[model samples]
Target: MHSRIGLFLSPVHETGQDPHLAVRRNLDLVEHADRLNFDEAWFGEHHTLGWGLVGAPETMIAAASQRTGQIKLAHGVVPLSGHHPFHVASRAVHLDHLSRGRYILGVGPGVPFDAKMFGLAPDVQRRRLDEALPTVLELVNGDSRITQKTDWYELQDAKLQLPRFNPHGIEVAMATSGTSSSSPRLVGKYGLSMTSFALPFALMTPGAPDHIGLAQQWKYAEESADEHGRTLRREDWRIALPVHVAETRAEAFADVREGYDRWLFEYFGKAAGREVISPDTPRERALEARVEAGGALVGSVEDVVQGIRRMQEATGGFGSLLVYVADWTSYEKTNRSLELLARYVSPQITGSAARPQEAVDWAVASRAAGR
Candidate 1:
């Protein structure tokens, strides 16, 4: 398993606090992550929600590029269905140039709420994504004139005027959940990296077999590689999650529980249209459920290290592990979490405090097997 730690710039609101403060705090956190020797720092893009402050990740990446050196800037996802392909490609290219090839473009079609906010119909979104992906790839690869005649969009000799920092291309990754969709296959087809969070619901449906959803994704990658007569390098796959670490498991759980209840269950749940209860569904309950279901990672330094190792083994050894350190919590607590993970958890997983690539072969071969 190739291991690296990352922080999620997910914002949480507290009473009497300015929501935009979250954005500023996240920038500070990124600087800290860089100093702490983290491999990447990610920012999420969302609209009409307090869950994330960044609505335009390209602009955020540009700002972040100037603030730090060495630490890679990632857009947890740029909603592909919400923006024009040419515009997205142009912005990313500019950031890559500005950062000197330190940008990781993570993109997805986005959630239902995102589509609704952008007034995109389902059919239009599907068609746009299919057409836009190829166009974006071409643009990133230095193709200036991309003409596409599609149902959702039409382009006539559209091209990017920016100079390419990477002629071969910088790293491109697809953001996904645990769904047996063609999206994962598309990632393999393009030989792009894959990054996903835990969506236990998808794997726990009434008729869903245990880990079936995960297996489906693995299968898709494998089959897509086979169909293309090539395998995706293992180093191109990643799994991201919200992680909290402390000196002891009890302390770690205690510190994060209140924040999880407030930010995750109360704040995010309400925003996501789920019921929130204080006592009946306490923060601990929510945390325990997700932990058992393989969603969030919370524990002492040793426990977190063990959890990471288990996940690495389960995925047949993945390449990258993105850890989210920001979410409705105090600056001190969040910083402490980042420090603990960086000091203790990261070294154990990466084995040398750098990126790991040993799992690349297995990832490629597994994707070729379609599972």
Candidate 2:
């Protein structure tokens, strides 16, 4: 399993906060992450939720691409139901070309509130996604004429003016949960990668199980491949998590406590209409609950590493482990956490070559000289 770490661009609300400052801070993290040799930096989209400032991921990624080199930019998820197929295809293709093919287009039918924010009826989201996905796929694949008529949308002979630069185009991924039937089936049918949260609601629900969620998704992918008479490749599976790492278990928990709790409350509690609390639960129990129910990784470096290894063994080794590093935390701490993971944790898992001795020696010498 290739274990590359990616940072989710989490917007932070601070005391005396300016909205634009969050964007600047997030961009700063992207630049720092790129410099630290992180594989990818993902930007998420939301509307009416002060939780995130990047309502348009394409525009944000365009800015990020110019600011950094060698780090892939991903729209963690763009709500497919909110836009016309032509627009989504055109914009995604443009970002792909702009980033020189360093773009991963993640598409999903987002939360019901997001649909409501866009003046769209939540009931029609499935129909919209079903209608839009195929058309967008066809258009992005360089089709000049696409004619489709559906209950939610209709397109006739839609052709893209900008020539498709990426022959493979952007890799498509679906963000799904355990109980979502359409998303898993769509992922299989389209041969797209799958990324779903081990989220609270999905895990704690009576009918849904954590491992069962992953198993069902893989089952669909396998069936889809069998129907097409091809072996399913490893790169098609990704597991995303909220992770933090430090030298010791106590230090890791302490470092992440405030920010992690805030994130849980904001994202899971408030966003999902669940009861909010001060989170008196112990860190281990909280993490276990998330892991068993939703899939959060919060522990010491060794604990995190072991958990990832277990996940690989359990899931038959997925191709990617997308980590969330950004939240309501200091930029320096976030960078340090990423550096520790890259130096100590990822090397053992991914077999990436170690940093050269000369660079390490120079850093030590520079620090000694300064002292």
Candidate 3:
């Protein structure tokens, strides 16, 4: 099977831009991805940061499901720690039917800031997720009554009222940053897929790029899967990172420098309480560092191809590459970048296969139906 290329939209618009317009632009992006024949799109949920303003990714996914077809839709994640598993299962079933089995359930422990805002501590969120996830899985895939009582929530004799559209049941993925995270083991134990967030940062060790560190993470996942008598295939592994492909290296760097730097320092750095000033070093060297450690992709198509090959070599091989969404320049430029990736970068990695004609027909009819 060919490696898949996909998009992960945190939907981080320029701060203070009208929120309504930002959402419209995001919708436009998903539509464009569909037309470009991208494999999937993962929408994110965040409560606090303007950079990640979408609080209910399901609302967005439901809307996008109408406008496009063929691309799989994921929550990127739903913060299960704060939600009732019964409700999450119901919604997941409804969405699966609505999307005609195109939905992938991605669940994560709530973000620290969002969890605090909801009046829960970090450890509390972890505990909640542990209780909620299995309950959700049982509710979605099993017919038996599920009664569970936890300190934070309770589900008593809960069963999904709606039948799943996909007879095989929904696929699940957990987000994790590294091997040490309990998330890998937990997901592995359940035969769920794993999403490695921030591929560049995860590959880092002591201020340098370390592919060995990346392999070690995969090793942990493999071992965890084995211990639980579950199989985790390398092709089920997805690694996501920021990527922007322009006509030239200089052009790509210029397109992303300002917005990327602001995101690095203000959104991430401030959240972590550190100063991540852009280096006074030469532009090329600094840009290389950004790719190696910062997880930002800024270059031509050839550059992106080389980067993916390097990543594949590091991980031994994985299923998919998800491009992190960034409209640092403009929406038009962002759309153009996707076109470039689909046209040049993806074919280079996965081979040039024509977009299936049935997919094209399905998208056309779905767009015409407006649902």
lDDT of 2 by residue, 92-196 (tens): 889988888888888888767678877778568877887788788888875569988776567788888887667876788888765657787788787777876
Question: Which 10 residues in a row give candidate 3 its minimum summed lDDT?
Answer: 199-208
User: lDDT for each of the candidates?
Assistant: 0.71, 0.72, 0.80
Q: Against the true structure, what is each candidate's TM-score? A: 0.86, 0.85, 0.89
Give the number of the best model, judged by lDDT.
3
Candidate 3 structure lDDT: 0.80
After superposition, the stretches of candidate 1 with alpha carbons farther than 4 Å from their true spots are 1-3, 11-16, 199-212, 275-284, 326-328, 353-371
- Candidate 1's TM-score reads 0.86
Q: Runs in model 3 with CA error above 4 Å?
A: 1-3, 199-207, 210-213, 275-287, 353-371
